[model samples]
Target: MKAVQYQNFGGPEVLEVVDIPDPKMFADLVLVRIEAAALNPADLAFQSGAADPLVDSLFPVTPGWDLAGVVEQIGVATAGFQPGDEVIGFVRGQAMHYGTYAERISAEPRQLVRKPRNLSWAQAAGLPLAGLTAYQAIVHGLKVTAGDTVLVHGAAGGVGHLAVQIAIAQGARVLGTGSAASQAFIGSLGAIPVRYGDELVDEVLKIAPVGVDAVLDTAGRGSLSTTQALAAVGARVASITRSSTEYEGAIDVYARLDGDDLTRLVELAEEGKLTVHVDSAFPLGQAAEAQRVLAGGHVRGKIVLEIREEV
Candidate 1:
């Protein structure tokens, strides 16, 4: 089996593809032949040692969390899935090792969900982490509801774009912030586009004079600083990029792997309510380059590594 691993944390350049033995499977696990693995900012953070103090890492770390693949075999005790099933998962383990940036991975049954039939392998690969982030923040954290005016920061980003669509799906009127160039893309997701920068607050206020009922901050770097002015009194506020402790009245969100939530996202995709836009797809050997592209920022959607030929 070929996998991407890094011996020392530094940059994307440290990643190397090497032939490793197949993962040790157990009765509680499923062996999946990975077809595609999506890249996320956290993949960069962990790889660069930015998350060292908070999360422990084994030296030779395989960095990836989101994957879409076909089941090559299932453990004896595994239920709800079988060999030949197509699945998607956010398979981040307790420690950084044996990630999805490989030809195969061993994931728990609870972390896997049937891939939406409508999405290609690349698109399905991109959904789990970002979709869960937006779903949890909008639905659980902010409690966005119909008729509420919701504001999403970084609306053109990987998580923000999905956050915008998820809010709309929940019946909220959404306003998303992005650069001027992304206005049309933001609008296409059924949200009013507000340009980023100092004018962001005023622009959001212009659309919702009473202030937005909820604010989901997908873009960190002080993006939540405008919460006081942009959100109405007692409005729900959440940030996936920064800690809630850093911002008053803000709930910090960390995406979790839940089969139930992933199932709902699959339903949304099947119903045409949710979609993943693949900004780029790279072969597995180019994991380094894919991470570099994600590090460049301003990516319109998810970037993925095609681990094998799409079935």
Candidate 2:
């Protein structure tokens, strides 16, 4: 089997596709033949040694967390998944090491979610991490509901786009912030688009005279003041990028892997209520190019590495 590995933390140039031994099936874990993998900003940070404090690295590292694959083998203890079942997984753990950017991966049953029939392998590959973050932040952290006005910062980016859709699905009247280039894309997701910057607060206030019921900030350029000013009298605020308490009165969210949560996201995608945009895709061995695309930033959705044909 072939996998992308980096011996030292540095740039995308460090990524190498090498022939490695197939992963051994561990107890209580299922083995999957990976079809596709998606790259995230955290993958770049960890590979470049920037996430050193948050992620303890084990060298000869394979850097990826989002995967769409088919079950090749199931552990004796694992239930609910059988061989040949199509599945998606976040594959994140307490430590960084072996991952999904390979021909094969072993995952715990708790990490598995049945893929929706409507999604292609590329779309399913993009959903796990970004979808999970948006789900946790908007649905759990902010408590957005029908008739509420919600604002999503960085609404054109990966997680922000999903957050916008989830808020709309919950029946909230949403106002999303993005650059001029992304305003139309933001509005297409059923939200009022507000170009972010000096005019963010004003645009939001113009759309909702009473202010927004909740604010989700994915752009961490000190947007606390804007969110505070745009908040309704008693609004919940959350930020995925700024997890520090220094931000004040904001719930700093970190995405966690939950099978149940992914299942709901899959249901929405299958029902055509949510969308996962893939900006570009590279072949499996071209993992370096995929990272380069993600590092460029402002991609409409996700960057995926298509490893093999989906069964």
Reference-based lDDT, each prediction: 0.90, 0.87
lDDT per residue for candidate 1 within 1-311, as digits (tens), equals: 89999999989999998988889999889999999999999898898898889888997999999999999998888888989999999998888987999999999888899999999999999999999999999998888888999999899889999999899999999999888899999999899999888888888888899898998888888888888887788888899977566568788898988778889999999999999989899999999999888899889989999987434
Among these predictions, the greatest lDDT belongs to 1
Looking at model 1, residue 20 earns an lDDT score of: 87
Error of 1 at 237 (Å): 0.9
Residue 168 alpha-carbon offset, candidate 1, angstroms = 0.6
Candidate 1 Cα deviation (angstroms), residue 208:
0.7
Backbone clash count, each prediction separately: 0, 0
In angstroms, the error of model 2 at 95 is 2.1
Tens digits of lDDT, candidate 2, 1-311:
98999999998999998888888887689999999998999899899998888779998999999999999998888888999999999898778889888989999888889987888899899999999999999889988888899888888888989999999999998888888999899888888998868877887788888888888888777766666677888888899997435346789898998878899999999889898888899998899988888888888878899997324
Superposed Cα deviation of residue 190, candidate 1 (Å): 0.8
